[model samples]
Target: MAKIHSHFDHVGSYLRPQALKEAREAFAQGKISKEELLDIQDRLVKELVHHQVENGLEVISDGEFGRSWWHLDFLWELTGFEAYQQEASYKFHGAKTRTTNVRLNGQVAENPNHPFYRDFEYLLSITPAGVTPKVTIPSPSLVIKRDHRSDLYADYYESWTDFLDGLAKAYHDTIQRFYDLGARYVQLDDTTWAYLIQQLETYQDQPEQRRIYEEIAEDDVYVINKALEGLPEDLTVATHICRGNFKSTYLFEGSYQTVAKYLGQLNYDIFFLEYDDERSGDFAPIVDIWNGRDQVELVLGVITSKDPALEDIDAVIDRIQEAAKLIPLKNIGISTQCGFASTEEGNILTEEDEWKKLRLIKTITDQVWG
Candidate 1:
């Protein structure tokens, strides 16, 4: 697999266009047929691909136009999982999302008929010759860590470890399916690891709570690596580690120092890390874990996707230089801290603001890496 050594990259996803959003709502209420809804999605996605190329992004996506939420839509499509209503929505800094979550229906397994496989085919179909069409799904770690239905595990698996293996197998087979379909680049958007960082921080004084979070963190690392097993070498895989992003609100804040050891053990070609603000902390922990791994690129998210304001290019360059003191500049890339829309609700930013963010990144990448 060749490295994604491009100086600029993006966390895959864009704000869902209003037409597609309205079409989805109408379908839910039975005002439109599935075929009609799909027609809107197909048309919107094609326009998104063209706009992405025009905006100068070498890597692009379908804008996740067909989904309600970034991770939940993908999760529910997998076998043995179904979307369920939770009593409380995910708590964020200033917002509460719809009361949505997932639950286990049976022992987790791969669904060959998974919609993402078909979606990836569409993405490949419309992508131009030179641009990279990236497929973003919630990480395998997410499926394991987000399973809150503990009582149902007894009906599905022999032990907790077995359940973990089941989740990994599902993702492993599913990811392989994507690769077989001509997907050269895949990005796993993970909040589990970053959630662990927050847990350890919030529970630092409580030994029991701290222990539980630590144990789950270790389990997540195992599940993730297990899923990547046996995949071909030429497939470029990356993981974007971020705290929850929904409606311009975040779930937690912390340093990578908490999860440095686990980050070192993962087998990914690149790490699309969140460093948009002080919340992500310094790059020393990154240096400690990623040192000497020349094949990997530490793509920094210096620009804020959660807000409409653009970052000062020179200040962004200064931060990259700061990270360069630890990791080589050649191996460091630049991107928005996360996607413009991690969920279909989108961030507080507008479509034009999103494009400006990309243009700013292109300007920065050209100046630093040219």
Candidate 2:
């Protein structure tokens, strides 16, 4: 099994074109059939993939055009989970998100007919010959942590340990299925680790909150490792740690020092870390964990996805060199801090701006890695 490396890659979700959104709404209103809606999505996805190729990206996603939310959509597709409308929305910095949530509706199990596999298949069929089709799913810990309403799962499992056991087996089986379907690279999009970092600042003086944070961190490590157990060595597993992005607003702000120890224990081969601004702190914590581990590479997200501003190429190159001093230059890569749009609304940037940002990423990557 050969290791996979790339100078530049994206964090998955792209802004949804207005036409596709209209088509989805029409389908929901019963004006169009499921086939009609899929046709619209297929056309839009092809255009998005073409743009990715045109921009010089080595890896491509379907732009997540077929779904509403990044993580919730994937979770709803699995067995034993149900999506419902909540009374209140998730509050972000100066913004609010959709009032949607998911819960365990029954005993958890891996659905052999998960829709994401089919989505990946479509992406693979249309991708260019040399380009690798990457699939991104919410990390097992993210799902388990978010859907933690006691009332929702108490009836389904005898204890938290029992629930975790089922969740881990389901994820392990799903990853194997992904490999069997020709997926060589899969990324686990996780924000729980970032949330934990934020909690450290919000509850530093509170002993109870500190204890809760430590417990969740431990569970996160256990669940993620269990989910990745026995995965094929050739399969490239990457984890993207984000601080929540919705319409250019963030849900949390803090440094990575709080969760540095847990991050070092993750089994992922690549780390798509958010480092576009001061909120993410410095690279010293990462340096401590990386410690010359040649197998682990860092995809520095020095470019901001939340804004349309183009980064200075020379400055970006200098930052990459600075990171190289901590980790080997050969193991460094470049990407956006987060996706252009983590949800359907996307950030407050024009489509043209998004393209410019990607082009900037390629330009910086070439100058540094070449």
Estimate every model's Cα lDDT from 0 to 1: 0.86, 0.86
Clash count, candidate 2:
0
After superposition, candidate 1 runs with Cα above 4 Å error: 147-151
- What would the per-residue lDDT of candidate 2 be over residues 46-99, giving only the tens digit for each residue? 999999999999888998898888798988777888888878888688998888
Candidate 1 lDDT, tens digit per residue, 1-370? 4755577788988888888889989999999998898888988999999988997888888887767888888988888888889898788889988988888898888888988887789989999998888889888777655647444666889998899888899889988999999888889988887788888988999999899988888888898899999998888889999877888889878999999888888988889889998899888888855757989888888888999988898999998889999988888998998998888889998999999999999999998988
- Measured by TM-score, how close is model 2 to the native structure? 0.96
Backbone N/Cα/C clashes per model:
2, 0
Residue 241 in model 2: lDDT? 91
Top candidate by lDDT = 2
